[model samples]
Target: MSANPQWDISKALMVARFFHLLCGARDACVTPFLTLYLRQMGLIAPWVGILMGTKHLIATTWAPICSFLAKNYQKRQLLLIGSLLGSAAAGLLLTLISPLDKALVYRFCNGSSSLMLPINTTLEKELAPNHSAGIKNFTIRTKRSQVNSRVMMGKGNPQRSMFETTDSSLPLLHVGSELKTPGTLVNLSLAERTRAQDRSLALSLGEHWLFLLSMMAVMFWELLSAPLGPAAADSLYEYLDFVDATDCYRRLWVWKLLGMSIGVCSVPVLVVQLDCFLAEDTPRAAVHFYGYTAFSILALPVCFAIPIPNFKRREPGHKAIKALSLIGNDCLLFLLAVTVFLTGATVANIENFLFWQMQDQGSSELSMGLSVTLSLVGEILLHPFKAKILKNLSSLGTLGLGLGCLSGQLLYYSLLWNWWAIFPAQIFGAISNGALWWAVDALVEDLVIPGTERSLSVMLRGLFYGNGASLGSFIGGFVVLHYSLAVLYKTHCVVLSLWLVLFIAIQSKLPQHRKINYSKLLAVDTADASDSEEGAERDWLIKAMRDEHLTGRAKNKY
Candidate 1:
């Protein structure tokens, strides 16, 4: 790596943190407020729910659109444009009318912001340290996770089965398909396979000018982010999966996603309850509560940083680094999945509730601000745990526990109409989010995607999550618009039940193994007897074991 004093390690870390914060604040400011704004315009709860869900629906629609651009245009430039579009959406919200106008603007913003996924993931990879990308993934994911939870409100749910928060659409990106040589096939034919391809495009004068304008817009927003907010976590899952022959990155993602997705669906019911409770009283109290929670979550990244493994230099032959990076990458995927769902839900829930409340009472702007602040605080509580809890539990076990808590939280909150009841449910924010941060990053590292492909894998993993969130949000809105609160709650519970089943199924397949040889220091410390004496031998043995566990090697190589 080349040394540039202007771009030191600390600076890079700071930039990554800043980027995460920007996304968080923008998400937080919009979701809750968008809902509130709609209600003020005379839309009913059903309409508000539908409108809010549109955010995710639009995001899903745009994932492929943004992915196409990402492959064809300068990713950074596309992201800048996305940011501007998001700002335009916010600006448009100030002038509201029929639900249709609101929906159109919301969808546009959702799709535009969807472009951020690939660019954001790419930037995180760029800022990461070469050998200790695990730490980098952990740190970036944690920071972003917390921001997402705090601002977005916490994960949402369609059946209203988890902790309630605001919701937003998760962005998606497509990276052609799995890497492959020209013509190899086992189960599927070439026509059946989806190839992950990259195509380069020429930059024209018009494109360059548009890029410049977008950059300026992003800078404007970055300056205004302070005094505002939005964010989760899971990271060690990859290590456990690697050891467990049946647990691959894809399967673990399915389970973690199930838990997180259920949470995403729950936000609106909680919002309605909160809105009704505050209808007869002061709504500002709720906002203050949200604010307090958001500020609290900002402390989490520092907390997790204390326990993460660090590598000061590259590993010899990059073997240890490769393994660690793979684990971290897979874990990152899991964490991103959880956080994205939480954020999307939180943003959606807050918006739905705020719209219902504000429309009903003609509440002051201050009260609305306070409500958003309270949601942000809830997310803050969630940020720290992304990496901390994984120190003990397997990815599935941790997620299972989190989902169980979420189910209980939803049912408990649904029974009580009091505002106080909302607080107890919000507690799930920390546990579910923490697991996301710790478990997913570990998965990424354990997967050990090569540097050349790291950016694509991370983006695609993000797409899976973003796409799921979009669908979940849309369905949640559909349920809200068509069903009673009871129906909504019951539906949420059912979805969560299904999510639990999927999680269990995936968990059942997880492979178990002993810990990796962490006896080495500085990537692959030669001073350590383990690294020098047995590193290669152990590496071969581990590979042989995994190969046998996977498909049973037909022939063995020395």
Candidate 2:
């Protein structure tokens, strides 16, 4: 291939969009479902948590090392493509592992969800869009919007929504729109309880061995996938600069949100269509893993096509050292790290296990899909206003706002009764997930010791998203095991509340010299900048990444 080869901006954007879309879809297919998928394998809550926590732990630790090695060699083409293919192969291998496809304890658990059927199903004429079941599925609502749960919680049948579709005059109910009572193992017969205990005992015999084995498998999977995030970010900036699209770079990431919704929504469709063609006992959830593989493989080809300009760069070790040096000098640095860590812990809770909780509430796959779509929509709608938000909330306050939103979302989730109500609550994600990321990214950009901009970003993200998420998932999993999902989410709200107070206290006490220049980075996310403001911010961004001789010291404060 020729060096400095040109790609048309339209062509580059199309390729870039496709790349992100497919990757987002690939990740979405498995992410919201993975913990529940593990649960379907007869492992309880803590084991699932351990596996996920370890996965994040490995991914985070390995990521900075991957970046360090890449900078040393300065060749990402081979590594990026290899990671994608390897991650895809790992997912495929996961699907290939048997008995996990079916929720086999003693017999196949058929389904593991407990979504409530709409209250007026008999009076209704059509099922909600989320429900695709046509195969004579019978659910009797005890109250309007309450699901007639035949199976216990966490035993929702995937096939009911996938294979049982009909045009009959049966009123379509939104399953788990309301719960008649808080769900538990209370309603089972003595004999049924005995059988459940027997199954539990049997599962316990092999639980430890299996947990270790699954943990290893997932750690291996994440090892291949973790570095891709930073690599993708790097490639994104490079591609944008090549196409002269840096001015609109932040908004361009909206494609990722769009793609994630598509991927999540696609799962129910795939499960339904595949069930029509597959066998009686085929594992329906396998569609998630296999579908993810397909998208990842599709994205592999697009990786080669992205016009990320290849260029020589220096080793990032000294830069990393400079970034780390700030920890000692900056008093408020601890507070920032704490906030990011807590944020990561809470976010990992929501993304990793929220659907699993909803499933326990008798939620359907279709409803979960809608939940994800709405959450992403909220993020897309709310993220662009970051500049305005910063202008009003100021640095500390914006960070607090993000944490507040996360806490509120967790609070809402803990009290979740009507599954339909969960849709509106996801608006909290706009601030918690999207605006929070923007605020942190911008703060890192502003607060770093000048030339160590990129290094500091990677370092802090590794701390929070890697270690913080891992720690939170580990603890949160046990919480779900001992208490309930509701209790765990409520606990998250409490933890966030305390963290927020601690954060504000520390930030308020910080001297002016220790604060970061948040105003300078306000334009970090604004694509709608006027002509005068746009030129300065764009140049600063471009030069920040490229300039080796950056002309600033510990001048910027947060």
Candidate 3:
């Protein structure tokens, strides 16, 4: 690569799109099947939960470190290294090993290799010729991929209205419009203008193709991984005695739910794809592992093909300080973190409790699968309306509504013993999980500075979902062991009620509009800006900071 490389954006995007698709394909083959893999290895309930939690814990721990490294090192180089290491780790899974040893290797590989996605996303943003155009392309492509995935899964076409909703929010080009140039238009021929338009259209089309490739990657992966979990659970059930099987299955689902929640909140790059080899049949396990390993190896060259512009390394000292200061200064962020944590715990508890409750009532694995599938469908259908919901209700109000829906679902579940009734309750699950998480995502974006979004996003995921799931899994497991699922539901309701009260209190105090005082927050030198307009902007910035607890030293820094 040239030292001063001016890459063709269209070609670069094509490479990126293909790379992401390969990544999605590889992960899809592995994650949802992990629980069954472990079961095949003869691991039981709490151990499953422990292993699942460990993976999240490792990933969460490594995310920040990786983020820092990506900033300072060549991103393409890091991608190459991560891909190679990941392939090696996948191959290692084929070997005979103790359960503990396998879990350790899996954690190391999963956590370290997971850096590729976030790094890739950041690299995409850096390389995009036009950020708004890229965002639009990404949204469109993701929607198309989602539709394709649903169709393949035998779900019918998604609502056409969803396309309209997504388009309305995205920035779109108005085609057939005349271009305004600085020079005299009379000097330019009609054919020249037409050529310009064609070039513009070509760029747009390239962006679309790029995004389509990325989404296809995700869609294909989802298709491969979706059925693996339920199938694995069924397989595991056959191996154990009835009582042990029920307990193991419940724990497996709980860990799976926790893993999903963490993956959603944490690293955009890291996905949860885990499967294990059969303990008794080493040969079969080797075959399964080798198949995935070969696929993973095939993905390596594709990683090298992605073209990311080199970035100069800056000392990351300011990163650490900025992160610490933001945490200390941002009270609302702290409260939101707490709210997400409690809310995650409540969701995890209720989901596990409800699933087992239905099963205990004689619901077959098929029925449980249908319930999960429908719930996922509901969530997907609700997603397009997320921006509108936030617009009308505000982030806090949307969250409140989601919490209310969750509360209602829990209440309904408590009152009914019938398994079928839970399906309708999934409407509540869909709204709460979908809308609430979206609200939180929006709120985080509004609260933080632009450069800090990735770190904050990872932090929130770890605090709210990662630690929350770990805590919930341990607590839920012990409670189920000692007490009844009914008891767990009752406790969940009370806890959420108390959390709602606290959330309301915090929401009341937050500024209705989330404007930050960058002058004070960033400590920009404004001494030269003595003009009235610049002075006024600086004054407004200071006041905004003051409202959020600006210190005397901070105020003077600018």
Task: Find the candidate with the highest lDDT and give its number.
Answer: 2
List runs of model 2 lying over 4 Å from the truth.
7-13, 100-201, 238-246, 272-282, 514-558
lDDT of 2 by residue, 293-358 (tens): 888888988888866566554433575566667755666665777777887788887777787656
Shift of residue 15 alpha carbon in model 3, Å: 4.8
The estimated TM-scores of all candidates read 0.47, 0.74, 0.53
Report the candidate with higher lDDT, 1 versus 2: 2
**How many steric clashes does model 2 contain?**
32
Order of candidates by TM-score, top first?
2, 3, 1
What overall lDDT, based on C-alpha atoms, would model 3 receive against the true structure?
0.49
Report lDDT per candidate.
0.37, 0.64, 0.49
Q: Which candidate, 2 or 3, would have the higher TM-score against the true structure?
A: 2
State the TM-score for model 2: 0.74
Question: Which one wins on TM-score?
Answer: 2
- Cα RMSD (angstroms) for every candidate in the order listed: 22.0, 11.0, 27.7
What's the true lDDT of residue 36 in model 3?
Answer: 34
Model 3 Cα shift for residue 226 (angstroms): 20
Rank by lDDT, descending?
Answer: 2, 3, 1
